[model samples]
Target: MFRLVVACVLISVSLCDDLISVVVIYRHGDRTPIQPYPRDPYRNASYWPVGFGQLTNLGKQHHFQLGQWLRQRYGGFLSPHYSERDFYIRSTDVDRTLMSAEANLAGLYPPKADQVWDPTLPWQPIPVHTTPELEDNLLAMKKYCPKYNSLLTQLFKTEFFLNISRENRDLYAYLSKNSGAQIASLESLEYLYNTLYIESLNKFVLPDWTSGVYPEKMAPWARFSFATQCYTEELARLKTGPLFNEIVEHFRNATKNDGFRKFLVFSGHDVTIANVLNTMGAFEYHCPPYASTIMFELRRNSSFYLNIFYKNSTQVQKIALKGCDFDCDFDDFIRILKPVLITRKQWDLECQNSNFGDFNTIFIYSSIAIGFLISISLLWVIIACFKQVKTNSNDYTRLAIDEVA
Candidate 1:
């Protein structure tokens, strides 16, 4: 009986899955609106202490709490002290994202003993890398991709979006009149909605006109607008592909024992979270709240497996990929996402290609290419002629010298 009980305990231990690595992508904490609409009552910088779109004290607290929760959840897996080899962090170039990462790090790796730089402050600096927003294709997704813009424009012109625009024409006109801004498309409407939502969250009294359709009528459209950025497979490939590809590469590296890093953190915006969730086919139409996080955990029992989680509220809920189980085999996870997984080279090619129903773009590129070729050919001909002329000149000189001799 003792031997049997011991055997059962060992078997149970062997069957349990062990988490090996984690990748967390999260939205920045709360912030003031990016910009006020034309007629916003609280448009003055005085109303927002830190000015436009900057993270607030509340935002700092939110991220610090989130970091604490992360430390609690991953205490066993992660090192107690900050180690460059064990953890990595990256944020978009935006000030809010950068500040949020710093606040989160303050909680995640609070100084202890010899690591303490300032004992009074109880905090230590940790590196958070970033690229310029315009050049960042990985996190910000703001890199200029003409093809992506072209695809989005085409998507807006589709019958479904057209119908939505026609249906919301009255609402758009009403908003435009009240806000003193042109609210024509869902995109424009979403921007207004976001500003108003942020103002409301900050306890600013909204104008009377907002009562008619502030959230009830406009919220759905605003949430749906997030979906439009990555509505199609092509858009997903261009928008979220680089980040997802990087995540998968990290997992692959861990499986092969190629990298020592076990924790990766990405601080970005709501749209960043939305894009990732949408690409994973797990997004539902709702604004990802401030400081919301998506975790990709790699674990091993006998073989490797993946478990995805979303923490929008206090609870972190398991989110399975569409057509995949909650605890999915690593190989199966890769196979399922293979269709959406895009390499950096493929993303670049797709972004530069004008094959997506944009004849004008195609014509412009073709003209550039033809002009380049023609210019090169003309230069080559000119150089050849000059060389031939010099050769003839040399021959004539040699002939004259022979006659003289």
Candidate 2:
């Protein structure tokens, strides 16, 4: 078995020539919502000092941990220093996404003698190229889901669109907003404010029961759409635009022809991951986690492999990120890519205790619970004794008054 496995590995390595390129698109870490509608549960601006949709300290740490993971996972794949001949990164122009790429870079490429943080440490700022917001990014979505756009064209007009109104209040709030556009409801002719007045008759309620609806799914769609679009666009930007079709060419070439980069990483969100896979007919029930990463490795004579891993740690755990194959053609290599959710605690626990047939988790949990109960009981007893003493003092004072009388 060992000999056979070694032979198989050698056969796989000989397949591709030297031609490596990688495109990683990921969402910025956890951020405050950009803004909430007037009726939103958490609409107060003070809810987030950064004023919504901005990266928080936690978000930074999440990406920072991922950066460390990448450094370990792909030590030589990416350079510690910037080089014109290798490596390219792009993000949507939004502050959060842009900053996410930067944070990831800080981990991927730590400071060097030439690249220092302010004159103290050598850390250089790597650039993240961006694109215009509204442009169609079918290319980006194609990364994980090649079939998403065509699927979107189908999903766009489905009854599903009407079902998305519940959580989104942007629909009504935008109305009478900007002091523009006539606003009206079907049953009652109401005051016109945003374009909804003209569009409401044309528009029906979204899936959500809430009156305020801009199609809640669409708001999220745009957010993820941009994430997916960047992947394809960023790859193409490295060479030429969509016209050159560098994105597909690169993947196909990497897997079919030459041995491109040792490993390719694309950091992006669950939606982008979902949509791209949806488009490519890669259906994953798993929504991409924050700081989630998708990896592609080309192997054995034009054969390709894909695996996805998520990061949710402040420090590196001494375990490897798992992988799954991309759902391509069977004769061509299409297989099931099951969805999985990995948390830091679970991942850490998995690493520390990998022994099969052992019930360490169960024992650990039970022990912790029993210890907690004991501590609680001791505190309760101490409080009860104090209350009893106070009551006795009051009773004793009354008895002494009776004796004096």
Candidate 3:
């Protein structure tokens, strides 16, 4: 055991020495529930101090701590002064995630030199890039993709889902009765748990039924549901392909992009972390805790290598890839991901047509066919009316000639 520990430490040191770039994807910190169950006591946004889905002071502190940890881990490697050229940050356009990134940056880079505008405040503003919430496809899972939706429907009917649901039937019944909402499915049950967990965390008194076994059982159920949602090779690829593609693109372009930043930070949700981890075969059965993070460091070993590290709440562990070691060759990593990874263009195409069916193309063809039939009918009507008018005029002429004779 002692030798093993020492060897692990030496390997970590070697990897750190060769580290060339990093990408950190993290969940936003604690926040008020985005919504509440129908029968919950705290259904209104007014119940929380920060309103619905906004970050609280505690959340700020959580992210601030995370930022400080990042600094401690990479401070020696990063420039002492904050540089736009050295670091880049992006987050979901939502309030909590965007705020979390800002809070994190506050801890990551404090004011230095003439950068200090006011001695009273040690913090400085850092720009975070984001698209409008409606247009956002990377972090927020709200983007509408018909193919993904269809795939998810098919997933729910698979044997895996059936087995898990059968096993948890009793738990589902209990949750439905006690969770103050009708739990129609595992996804609905998860919503109830999320509300209960957040409300309880905010010091709201939970119902007597949720005291002990309920939470324990519900936690696993939640993880199982989440895992089933994206565990399959195909499901993970479709749901998280864009994010995976973005990370790889950043790494691949590191050499070509001018003034390449050493760090790329993504502030996102628990789903984001879980799905990405699942794709890499590094997922834990537990749902990622608030402020959880996964760090992928690209290192220049004999050949370039990718080292993936996962942190849940506090403990950070090295995650071995499915087909490779913990520190896998970058080329090998890319090859392993090739089947799952997709380009932005391919993603758009898949969204329109998943090969199962092309709804967009079908809709277009159906519209054209309907339009052609309508045009032909209108032309026939016009020709018939013109012939009737000419026939009436000729009859009138014949009557006039008879009267003149």
Candidate 4:
């Protein structure tokens, strides 16, 4: 029994040392409400010092702590000093996300040795890449997708959602009267809920009208909206598919190259995190808190494997893939996610509601066919004119010969 226990311990230690790379997708930390309802008491800009939709000091601190947690988790694997080759960070083109990434990096890679430019400052500048929201389909996913929009429209009209709206008519009417904004749709209701939730979190006294239905009555419907973006397989494919596919590619690349990047970080919104979780079928329908994160670790033990973890608060818990175990084989992980994974080209084509390449090919062929027909008609006309002229000349020659005779 003693010998067996020693052998198992040795095997466990070996497996623990096999981590190759990690991908982290995390929400930006807490911020002021996006916007206030028409009747909101805290509507003044002074209430939020950083203006609307910007990160707060509290938010920066939350991300800094999260970064510290990351350092603790990856200290053994990552280099002590910042290295561009080993780490890549991307954030949504939003002020909050950009600032959050900066704050996180401050904690994760504090200046060391020659990296310390200032004796008093412990932080180092790290590059965080971003794309315009209009064109970003990977993290922000704000790029207009016609098919996705059409699906969303269809979803709202479906029996399930229509019933939800019908049942909430009274709630909507009450909220509209109190908040002085239309709250008929789940999306609008969710916005109101978020503002109120943020205000409540900041210890701002809510109006008396909200006491009855502030949280208990409205929370479920608000949370439901988070899942709707990637609720269906088709929606998931068009919405979060590109991000998932990109993460998979990173893991595959790591397998191929020994010197590949060690860590990739994405700073985004709660919706970004929720969409990914829902698409993966591991979401539990709560608003992902500030600085919440989902991590994907690629490991090699006899063979490559994947481990996913979710950190919403103080604790980090291992989350199994919907149909796989905690330590899932890499091949099995890919096979299970095949249904929702999509390439950038596929996403682009699907978003537009048609295969544009095929459409362009057909257009080119049609133009060529039309040009060929026109050329054929011109050639026939030319031949006819030549034949007529030859016939006239022959007649004229015959007439001349007769006259001479």
What are the root-mean-square deviations of the candidates from the true structure over C-alphas?
Answer: 6.5, 25.8, 4.3, 6.5
User: How many Å off is the CA of 171 in candidate 1?
Assistant: 0.6
> For candidate 2, lDDT tens digit of each residue in 269-354?
44544444433333334335467654433323243432222232232111112122231222232222112122323323333332
Which lDDT values do the candidates have, in the order given? 0.86, 0.45, 0.80, 0.88
Q: Predicted candidate 1: what Cα RMSD to the true structure?
A: 6.5
| Candidate scoring better on TM-score of 2 and 3 | 3
Evaluated with TM-score, which candidate comes out highest?
A: 1
lDDT of 1 by residue, 1-405 (tens): 324423432343232337778899999998998889989999889888797989999999999999988887777678779999999999999999999999999889999888988768989989999999998888999998988998899998999999999999999999999999999987799899999998888788899999999999999999988898889988988899888888888999999999658999999999998888888889999889999999888877678888788999676677898778877788888887777678877777678875545557778888999999999999999999999999988773355446653
- Greater-lDDT candidate between 1 and 2: 1
Q: How many residue pairs clash in each candidate?
A: 0, 55, 0, 0
> Could you tell me the lDDT of residue 319 within candidate 1?
86
Clash count, candidate 1: 0
Total backbone collisions, model 4: 0
Instruction: Please estimate how well model 2 matches the true structure, expressed as its whole-model Cα lDDT.
Output: 0.45
Candidates sorted by lDDT, best first: 4, 1, 3, 2
Model 1 misplaced stretches (Cα beyond 4 Å)? 1-17, 355-405
